[model samples]
Target: MSAMTGELAMCGASVETLFEESVEPVVELVLGGQSARVALFGATVISWRTGARDRLWMSSLSARDGSAPIRGGVPIAFPQFADQGPLTLHGFARTARWRLADRKANLDGTLVEARFVLARSAIADTQGWVGDFELRYTVRLGVRRLELELQVANLGSAPFDFTACLHTYLLLDDVRNVTLHGLSGLEYFDKVAGRDRDEVNDAIRVEAASHSSGDVLGQRAEGFVDRIYRAGGERSPLTLQHAASGETYSIAQSGFPDTIVFNPWVAGKKGTKGPDFDDDGYNHMICVEPAITREGSGPIRVSPGSTWAGTQTIQVL
Candidate 1:
């Protein structure tokens, strides 16, 4: 419930120390009956557990858990999918282990910055994608904000291409109780349906949509919401406010062209265990993804050596 105060860690087993000792920073954040463990050095949010309920986050979508073993939560994809050749699913960025490059703190102790770096390598088994790449991720935790900045560098002889996003799953008291503002007008695609390819719609607000789970827990917002928006807002940040706690978390992104929103109301979308809608697992988490490609369901190609960047900030109010 409380931090260990002005110390390098919260407890002897602080999240920071967890990484230094084990060569992996796995910190568990448990709040409102939800639990998630994130590895700072790994730059991955590994596991998410809700009380005695069950695990909703999937490390694998198919028969295997994936060659690059990421525990779950949020992952960063760089130089994206190279026409789906060697790398499948997202790409090589998340699967490879990044180096701990930087760490900084605010004068008031309200904010913290830590960075992860991924360089080009001839590892051979790295999904066959080659390019000198640098991915820098920063975490800023202030009194009111927690933000992430991803700075990428393509240092190869050729330009590298890819679509990227911070695949973050925000846990909510109830998905129905949450409202996503800032995106009302844009173009998006419906993944659930085979037809209606990338269509344009007037700005749609979250509150206006019907929650309509119509089941035991009432948390099914049926459909696949993966699209790209020309986020032309002056704020450049998307806000998510929870009515019950009066807590507002802002999901901000800049330079990224697409925002993918998905709520798996089905039993399972891609063969992963669907959160027990009966107990409210999937309904409690919302993924407001900032992506680089608006062209959904297709491979985002990167040339030989071009770099791209994006960021996401979370401010709790």
Candidate 2:
């Protein structure tokens, strides 16, 4: 591990690298009363704190020794999403070690930025996928907002098609007390039911009943939920509001055409939890992911020497 630290004399913003004995290095960014932690193992933002509260939820059983993918925070899904392709689940970017390309703070120190790079060589195996590629991930932290941008550049001579996403887990007072706005009138593919359906309500609430019944307006979400909403070329921001705390988060994405909402309400047959998730974890966290692939739509193609990028910005409102 490199013994390095960056400081800004103008303000309270600073970037420091901490090394653990066996695990990868972790980068900490602090500005004013807000802070964020990034682990190089997957270039994953494991923690983000603002207003003295943690807005990102992390699973208590998540592995910290780079043994497995961290269960929470903003995990980068690249080259493939889930079992959509022949590659591993969510691709290898979430588990592969990333290189810290750069880190710095602005002149006033009100914002901090860090860049991580992953090349084709870093990936041990690409599952027979051809095409040399490089990924650049940038994280910007402000007092009340966090921005994540992913750039995929094709360096090979041939064009390649792939899918990607920013899997973000948001912590909430209670998943049932929250309503997600801005997905109204759109169509979504429900993974749990393996069907396509239309969203009728302007505000989407967690419901225990199946949404296929057309009467999911006021119900609470209790069962396992996994749906991908198509938002092609739409720039409208989605808002997640916690009823108990009055805390609202505005989630917006660019270059990512789909949004996936997921929650494992009941883990197993009897609501038993998985190894990396708590029995009650579903009650406190929800994932509103920004993705680049749509149902029945194929992967995105990038020409030689061309680059594809996506940005997801979350703000406290």
Candidate 3:
């Protein structure tokens, strides 16, 4: 059997092997003038660049030894999110190694796709969970757009539930100059205040009260901001403006009901901690996660022989 599978390109899209010395093999994908770097360790996309700028960010101090989850890029949170379940912090998917199941570049070379698979049979401890399950993660990189999809299928006779999220850290020229639009009047649970509130911000609004969206969801001049906003059936496009760069990015989601906006501005202040990030790094990246993290009401349940899937797309504008 072949140890891995790979394909060539026609126009410009191609998948190349990379980072052979790391704990897990890395794959470098190029589509037209845009390119991305993904590691098989967690099937994580660690870097994305178009032209002269990077769209994704990875912390300098991130643990690359595979002992802990890397502190940046797009980390796949599966089975459970946070400490809400019996599993570890963000589940095992982020740290567990994944297998490259398929790779292909379209004949036209306008797009490239890579598929990775993870199964219980591939894990050693199973993390105290039992069942026959397979998680399929697919990344489709096009010339101007990036699409990410996660599919979970149950192979056993019993039903199972899982909460998942694509924790995406977007690199920015300056966090203070960035703005997230189209999140008005939505509800959110403030992790710091431990309460639920409404988002009334219009243009990156930051209020005296933490966790509540005023008229906008903008970065503050100082301090940290972390909140989980609930987007209930609201599929309006979310846009992020990188003011300094004079560029804007649009985000859209399907099968994902909630969105998480977080930025730990300064380390070692107000109970904030970032062991893997540089103190000044907070001003360069922001996390916007598409997640379903409800305690018992939000998990995606897959019946025996059934499957559940979700997709999120990011585009540069």
Question: In order, how many clashes per candidate?
Answer: 15, 4, 12
For model 2, state the Cα shift of residue 311 in Å: 0.6
Two-way TM-score contest, 2 vs 3, winner: 2
lDDT of 2 by residue, 1-317 (tens): 23234355346677777898976689888888999999998899999999999999898877889998888888899888877878888898999899889877787767888899999999998888886899999999997999999999999999988888888999888888999998888888877677788888787776554344432333333466788888723734899988999988999888888888888675522334347876677888988888976473457899999999989889999
Candidate 1: worst-modelled 10 consecutive residues by lDDT: 8-17
What's the lDDT of the predicted structure labeled candidate 3?
Answer: 0.76
**Best by lDDT, which number?**
2
- What is the Å distance of residue 3 in model 2 from its true position? 13
Error of 3 at 174 (Å): 0.7
Better of 1 and 2 by TM-score: 2
TM-score of each: 0.69, 0.91, 0.89
Off by over 4 Å in 1: 1-15, 19-24, 27-42, 46-72, 81-86, 122-124, 194-224, 230-235, 269-279, 294-307
TM-score of 1: 0.69
Off by over 4 Å in 2: 1-9, 210-222, 232-235, 268-274, 294-297
**lDDT value, residue 272 of candidate 2:** 45
Per residue, candidate 3 scores C-alpha lDDT tens digits across 93-149 of 888888888888777877788888998777776688765789998988886778889
Q: In model 2, what is the error at residue 115, expressed in angstroms?
A: 0.3
